[model samples]
Target: MTTGAIIFMIIAMVTVWGGLAAAIVNLVRHPEASEAEPSPPVEL
Candidate 1:
């Protein structure tokens, strides 16, 4: 309702959605290798 509240809401929305967008872009640019083998377990 208030102007300050609206501004804060927008900032929060951008923070959340912006982080998601950045993560997606990063994943797309550096995708995981599906055919990669898992590392062998180390002996204790």
Candidate 2:
């Protein structure tokens, strides 16, 4: 492969994996609520 292709691949790989890592860290720091807020009754 060309040098540019390799660099682009590395950049893309880092972007995807980095995003995954960030999401995991965020979830660990702030988890979702156990109970969701109740929804209002629907009108006819």
lDDT of each: 0.97, 0.95
The residue-by-residue lDDT of candidate 1 on 1-44, one tens digit each, is 99999999999999999999999999999999977978889999
TM-score result, candidate 1: 0.74
RMSD of 2: 3.1
How far residue 25's Cα lies from its native spot in candidate 2, in Å, is 0.3
User: In candidate 2, what are the lDDT values of residues 1-44, reduced to their tens digit?
Assistant: 99999999999999999999999999999998867767689999
Write down the TM-score of every candidate.
Answer: 0.74, 0.79
TM-score of model 2 vs. true structure: 0.79
Clashing pairs in 1: none
Local error of candidate 2 at residue 40 (angstroms): 18
